[model samples]
Target: MPDVTTSVRRRAFLLWAVAALAYAVDLGTKLAVVAKLEGRTTVSVLGDWLVLRVQRNPGAAFGMGAATTIVFTLVATAVVVVVIRYSRRLASAPWAVAFGLLLGGALGNLTDRVFRAPGDFQGAVVDFIAVRDFSVMNLADWAITGGCALALLLSFRSSPMTGTAGASDAGAPGAREA
Candidate 1:
């Protein structure tokens, strides 16, 4: 059997590694979009089905709650705190990745909120990717959306966040023998 300490460390490492990678990618892409496309006309990548148009959003996805940028910032900060505080107990690789994505995405948007424009903690997030009849978004948005979906799936599967086994092996071959 693997040592508990070693297992915990491995999970923690995975979580941090994923978080760092997501954060880096989100930051890099956002910066590139801002520098290259902020003032230019929309660049079509695949007709009108997909395009890149720089937009600074002070609201949540789909540009909702434009008047509550500070609230979003606070909520994102809370997510970061909760994820970091609960990471020590992670045992499942999927859960770790989910939380890591959540953390990294939160931090990515949070950085924009803190430093972008319109003052600290009320700054707009840079969004560039747009789909037909859909709101503009970014990599951070994708990460957060994916993380939430994965977490919900794991929860439905009754996967344990801190255990040697996940759900059960009841349906496995020879899981039960006479």
Candidate 2:
């Protein structure tokens, strides 16, 4: 078996690699959507089930808190900081991937908030990809949502961030069966 440091190094690499890829994809898609769909009529992609349109949402999911763009920017910055700090002890592949997606998504939106429109840290996020009667969002939104879902699943399964069941299973009655 590899040493602990080696394992951690590998996991950290995986986390950052995934983060870079997710960030790139989110940024690329947003640029494309803005260039092609901005100011244009909504185009149906799946016959009303899915449509493409450009919208600048200065708010949270579903465009909530439209007046809190600066707050959101600060929150996103905090999230990025927490994720970086947590990565030091990353030992689970799933957790790494989840955090990676979260980091990428946060950075993507934060970029827009810092340098997109009406001023610094008060700009709107570019949202495209309307889903029928649902909300209009972008790739970053999907990444964040997916990461949260996976993290929830891992928690439900009692998966530890350390990638070991050692302490978590200790309290169970039959955990020490000989």
Candidate 3:
């Protein structure tokens, strides 16, 4: 078996690598969209199913909480801090990947909130990816959404209610065995 320290280091590396990749893609796409799509009409990529349109969102996902840009920035900062703190105890590879995606997504938007137009910590996030019948969003938004879904799946898989292996039910008040 791999030593605990080695395992942790490996997990940490995976987390950072995934986070970096996600962040890079998010930032790169935002830059490209801004450079190529700003001040222009939407460009269809999939027969109106998907299109590129430039927008600056000063709120959370789906254009909600537009007036709370500062609050969102602070929350994103807290998430990054929490992820870093929890990373030290990450023994599960899936959890590491989930947290990495969350971190990257959070940082990608946080970067805009801190450095983009309007002002510091109150700047708007650039969003472009638009679906015909859904909300317009960006790579970071997709990363965050995907990360949350993965994390929820992992949580369910590790829950005792799911009868996952190694999930102990011995401490339950009305425990029974098959």
In model 1, pairs of residues that clash are none
Better structure of 2 and 3 per TM-score:
2
Give per-residue CA lDDT, model 2, range 5-49, as digits (tens): 777887788778878888899899999988888999999889999
Worst 10 residues of 1 by lDDT: 169-178
Query: Which regions of candidate 3 are displaced past 4 Å?
Result: 159-178
- Cα TM-score per model: 0.90, 0.90, 0.88
Give a tens-digit lDDT track for model 1, residues 1-178: 7777777778888889989999999999999989889999999999999999999999999999989999999999999999998787775889899999999999999999999999779999999999999879999999999999999998887666654433344655434332
Model number with the top lDDT = 1
Q: Ranking under lDDT, best-scoring first?
A: 1, 3, 2
Which tens-of-lDDT digit does each residue in 117-156 have in candidate 3?
Answer: 8987999999999998898999988999988998899777
> How accurate locally, in lDDT, is each candidate?
0.88, 0.85, 0.86
Indicate the worst ten consecutive residues by lDDT in candidate 3: 159-168
Give the 10-residue window scoring lowest on summed lDDT in candidate 2: 163-172
